[model samples]
Target: MRINVLQHTPNEGPGSILDWAEVHNHEVYTYHPYQFGHLPTADETDMLVILGGPMSPNDDIDWIKAERKLIKELLDNNTPIFGACYGAQQISKTLGYPVTKAPAKEVGWAPVHLQSHVIPGIPETLQALHWHEEMFEVPDGAELLFSSDAVKNQGFVLGHHVVGLQFHFEPKPNNVREMVVNDFNYIPGSILKQTKEDILATKVPEENRAVMFRILDYLSQ
Candidate 1:
């Protein structure tokens, strides 16, 4: 399968997903809109994976707006899409949902309770990486997939092919460290009170990768 990953920033790339793609022998391509200023042609790719970024979906940047349009096109065609954090917000906005600031930003690692209806194959609770200040309102007709104490609309599925997640299922230790250092500016005031040790202590459990893989496998099937 040919998977096109849209990267919104320099540090945030397709972490564990890239490893999974290589292991599964799927072709991978990356587009950094910040640096390259171009969106991929949706018809050219088999699947779309949008990575997280510090920017909000409401930003007036040209590339951000263009990417939203591309997401809409992909959805209209029933193409599969997997989006995380800011990517998820874009998907929500493109689908006529509202993306707004969360009352409190969910940073560090947090536990997400899986919706019983979304993925009964998975366990009830899973620790996932979160680094976003904005949250999406579930679009009409979308199925709620997961929720955290800090954010209710953590994950949602639109139709059969579209999945959006507010947490990072593909986090690595180094990736977490890099994100902490590089994107600290976007950390909410509440999270800023946390010490570096406290932040580093939080992480997605190893077992959660299996759940992520399961979701990918299900989507691909």
Candidate 2:
């Protein structure tokens, strides 16, 4: 399968998802809208993976608007999509869901409690990498899949094809480390409060990855 990844920034790339794709012999292509232009058509894509970024979905960026349009097109055609963090917020907004600031930002590793059987193949609890200030409301007609202490709408499913997650199931150890070291500029709040050491310590346990892989495999199906 040809999986197209929509990357929002240089630091935010497909991590473990890329590994999964390579191991499964799937072709992976990426479009960095911050550096490149807007997203391309999904003509050749069998799956769409939207990675996270520091920006909000409501940002008045031209590229973000274009990507939202592309997401709408993909949804209209029933193309499989998986969105993370900011990407998930975009997906929610494009589908008429409201994206708003959370009571507090959720950073580092967190636990998401599965709210429903939306992702039928996955288990009930999973630890995932989270770094975001905003949260989205579950779209109308979409089933809520997961929730965290900081965010209620952590994950949702639209039909059988589209999945939006507010956490990072795709980050490998190195990916998380690089994000902390290089992308620390994007981190808000007290810089001294959240150190690179703290971020590096964040991890998704192996059991969580097992459930994540199940969701990924289910979406691929």
**Evaluated with TM-score, which candidate comes out highest?**
1
Alpha-carbon error at 49 in model 1, in Å?
A: 0.6
Q: What C-alpha lDDT values do all the predictions have?
A: 0.83, 0.81
- Residue 197 in candidate 2 has what lDDT? 74
Predict model 1's lDDT versus the native. 0.83
Give the alpha carbon lDDT tens digit for every residue of 1-221 in model 1. 99999998777778788877888999999999988898789789788999998788898999999998889888888888999999899999998878998867777777899884665477888888778878988888888999998778899987778889998987677777877788776565654356556777775577777777777776777
lDDT of 2 by residue, 1-221 (tens): 88899998777778778777877899988888877785778687788899898788888989998988888888988888899998889999998878898766777766789888766667677777778878888888888988987668788888888888988888778778778888776565631245667778765476655666667787888
How far does residue 214 in candidate 1 sit from its true spot (Å)? 1.2
Error of 2 at 10 (Å): 1.7
Q: Which number leads on lDDT?
A: 1
**C-alpha displacement of 52 in model 2, angstroms?**
0.3
